[model samples]
Target: MNGGAVLLPYRSNRPWLSGRDRKRIAQVLVLVLLVLVAAAVPQGPAWAGANLIANPGLERVDVGGFPVCWEKSGWGDQSFTFGLTGPGHTGANAMQITLATSPNGDRKAMMLENPSCAPNVTPGHQYDLSVWYTTTTANTVMTMFRHDVAQGWVYWTDLATLAVTPAWTQKTVRTPQVPADTDQIAWGVTIYGVGTLKTDDYAMEDVTAPATGTACSAGDACVKGVWQVLPFNSPVRGLHTVVLKNGNVLLVAGSGNDPDAFAAGTFTTAVYQPTTGTFINVPTPADLFCAGHVQLPDGRVLIMGGNKAYPAADGSHGYEGLKDSYVFDPATNSYSRVNDMTAGSWYPSATVLGNGDVISLGGLGEDSSGTVATQYFSQAQQRWLGLGEAHQTWNFWGLYPSMILMQDGRLFYTGSHVFGNGLPGTGSSIYDYDANTITPVSGLQNKDQRDQSMSVLLPPAQDQKVITMGGGNIDSNPDANRLTDVIDLKQANPTYTAGPLLPTGTLTGGIPQTTHQGKMYVSAVLLPDGKVFETGGGLHNRADPVYEASMYDPATNTFTAGMAVDPVPRTYHSSAFLLPDGRVMAVGDNPGNGSFDMRLSVYSPPYLFKGARPQILGLSSAEWAYGSTRVVTVDGPILKAELIRPEAVTHSSDPNQRFVDLPMSVSGNTIGLNLTSNPNIAPPGWYMLFVVGTNGVPSVAQWVHVG
Candidate 1:
């Protein structure tokens, strides 16, 4: 048996009569060989196995190192199917199976029954079952059970408790002959909720159950428990604001839990000394409520209004969102009163405009629900003036209101209906007053209203990108709980372009982050690096868990994180910075597990250093797409261009979307790449491009639109 050649079984033996048979066999063999040889020869660039199983479609085939599958959907009914079935008899009692879904928005699933099998199983027998599945929802489950002519079907009681990994979790269900149904058994996986999901290539082998004494000992072995990296070891609560400052972190707690009946003592705030990892006393105003902090360009931090917390015994004490604002001078390590709002308010948004004035938007006011009041600080006057209320007149609670400053200098607010949920009525947009005339971003209304939704200007670059992260729905449908989605605002609003779609897995709660310093600091910061850093945010349940922080390198259009994770898991946390020395800080609201001790954490560069400009590399169509060319060059100290596709000149379909992946082999200053070609060889489109670094961090994707 030659390793180079795979041999198939053949039958033959005679000589004279075999001579004639041999000739015929030779002809057939030559014909088959010629056909295969012809197929191997390519007219264009070779397909270097670029296709992967993007979705579980009907065409389940793997060739030349690539697994290809596709999906199709009708107007209403949808399914995941294929055209291949294998003939088998040698294996033990076998069942051929695959996964399927009912339709979109419908969470129910049905197993396509095998024509011959009655979904039966016998006790004292062993069976191997396998299923190929993918889902957009979590409540779906694989149900296995038994059936008898006399006693109906005895379903396995712990079917739903089996496993819970969102990805394809393969489980082998071994039966444990209950008192009921010793002879006949029926087993199947079923969907449990109201959303549509699908499975394919379902099959079973050696299907049977344990003889008599075997029953599942462990009932529910699902994934639980928080992955703890460090312990806070302190009992603190009502920690609303967290900040990293002056080689230390500060935890400004809203008065919540205490030992005193009327109140233990004075309102206290703790400062963390990273050098010792301990919280120390910090002099803050007594009864300080919830406050937001912003670092001045010169390094002072401005701390703004929050409500005072009273003892639990006192009925009138809780988060009292206030409008009084103060300034914290890190240099002096002290706090000072700056300016009071024109109106009584708390929970109002205080975002530092590009011009350095803090813009305070809607929050709960003394009058009622929340003030639609919008105010921007006049640096020259050193006072907060009423910019104007929202387009619609109503107080907002700002559960998750939109307070985004667009590239065109517009401030858009949405989701602040009550200080809790962003309803359609609560969703409103406001252009910056700087624009003289305020214009509403019409048509792109908040139909599927959102709360906790995030909006970030895809900072202006050579390519434009604006992105909005995860948000909760105002309406009742849970299916609207989308974990990840992308909007290319660049096409409609040329100035806005969001980052590329995250690779493979869903964004952990739609986290849109930028980089700062050598370390990927989240929350917010203008660390050692010139770029901005956004840590993590909480997302929908189905989305991949985001526990990591990434550095956004705008120069190169990429983000990278080697191994260090965030100091703590923070979703609804406040991340900002104090410049000059460039220390980044974060304070989380409902930090994971509601642990009040999940206090403010700050991050400085693991090592001190000057920053380097991002290395941008452009991919060339000739070198990477489908052409035989394979060369890449770093153009400016910032830009890199390479020929990634060259074979699609003739098949000019959408010449702008084609691209080829290359194997990077560094030779010297010049990096050598094996520019593999595609086989289907459609006309070249723009090549989607990215670059990896010595740190193994790859840049964001860019496209060299093919002509």
Candidate 2:
């Protein structure tokens, strides 16, 4: 076919052509038509995936002159204007939002609040969200909302904080798994400060797919784990979270960081049953808001010191502590009064001795000054010891100092504190209570900035090693540091040595930060798998929630970075503890804006999603004594066994929580686990016993009393 002319059949016209010629001419014409069509069609980016957003380019508008499938949304007292701007990143129109005066709240241009406009999401699947924006404010964050079948539309989480960009920039972030029962989701970029923000294209794509096959592998839920936001919020602010011996969680608020509640004497406490997902309110006798708590030998919680008074509004005075003490019997779910301490304590550190006595130190006294007296709670008498009975240290330790018990009955201060500049001297010391002496241990890096740092007793407690990681001086510093320090207390003179730098991960700013990006208020949970699961923290005091998580293998002394991140801002006043089911429960986040997040989230580790968890068939005895070996029957061969102390955590200062490895020899389904000879290694109290199968999956813990 020449000059786009069709080939005619052999007939009375031009020259006759063969059948092969006609077929070849027809094929040539078809190829030419395809070329024209291909040239006329538009081409997309090579890496473009299926975008789940509707009206992604803002090219379509509704009758009100607003972008279709989108609406202007905000809260608090903010004067703002929202409309279609010009020169979008991909189209002719872009959404523009301006804040004239934002004294409180925030504003955002988000997807419409209807089912037709919101993007549908699958439970337990993560999505990558991106948006092109240019903003004048540094206080912008990516926000999202989910539609729940039972609860309707609710705020999900602040995905990430966005950095200031004068020029249009495309920021991409991965959201934690879409919570269960969530049918759809809406998201947008938010401006909490006075600024002008312009946005163009928006995109969201599911990145996590459902697992395939029976075997577990990388990139699957079985390897990366998953996080789920509980449908119901905690009735009380979980300022104090303790994993009780009965497998229920005791959540203590005691004024719950609310100045008004403190003024009204509205103390609160609740017992949460993880199995039933229910809460039973307990009558609180005193203001235990910043109190010291630990599990007694008999499984009762000994709570001491608390909020006597809130700080003065004009800075003339500060928070005052109370000397009242009480004990909560888990069986009765009631608190009974105990003898008052010698001095008031607002944020004391409670360490249960091997003999069952409790020593509480460091906290603001009633007068708002450092409390110098060391208060001792006598388990035998169930009261605070008289001044003459207990020796005084005559030293003022900082608030919430991590005072872990050493094997020799001395206490090791790991230089971790909260809400202050830290103590004087080296910030870490060994206190011999009987001798009334303090020996300073050196080599802790940035001791003053260790506030809200987490000090964890390395798993297999016989190792006698402690790791302090990630801290910042919330009172004076603007950034936290990714520092990990390990100390071998068994040394002649134990001193902290630099360990591996915390592995890098994406920060809340939707950027992959360097390893130098650290965090404060970090929760380091001791896992039954003999690893430390570090998650939930903030870059600043109570703002800039960081989105980094990892599993620290004590055996290798290395961190497996990029674990699943919790979708909540677990900042100051947050706490996390291991549940009996090999999961971690995280709660509470009192941010700088004076708001308390009561939502709770649970994280199931990779081991749980792994095939068939080991099962504990029976134990020779639930009560274990020092220097003893017990026989445990399991459904399958176990590679290891552990005894994890029940958690009595508050302000991330639970020196009581430790993982004690039980040396085991497996023969078929029966295992012999030799308990430690030293009571100091595994303190005399209730513990959760877990057995790990050869497949690395741990069984549901069984409550065992170790003495």
| TM-scores for every candidate against the unseen true structure | 0.42, 0.69
TM-score of model 2 vs. true structure: 0.69
Q: Which residue pairs overlap in candidate 2's backbone?
A: none
For each candidate, C-alpha RMSD in Å?
Answer: 22.8, 26.1
Instruction: Output the TM-score of candidate 1.
Output: 0.42
lDDT of 2 by residue, 224-275 (tens): 6889999999999999998999999999999998999988889999999999
Off by over 4 Å in 2: 1-214, 217-219
Candidate 2 lDDT at 317 equals 76
lDDT, candidate 1, at 619:
39
Q: Scored by CA lDDT, what does every candidate get?
A: 0.37, 0.82
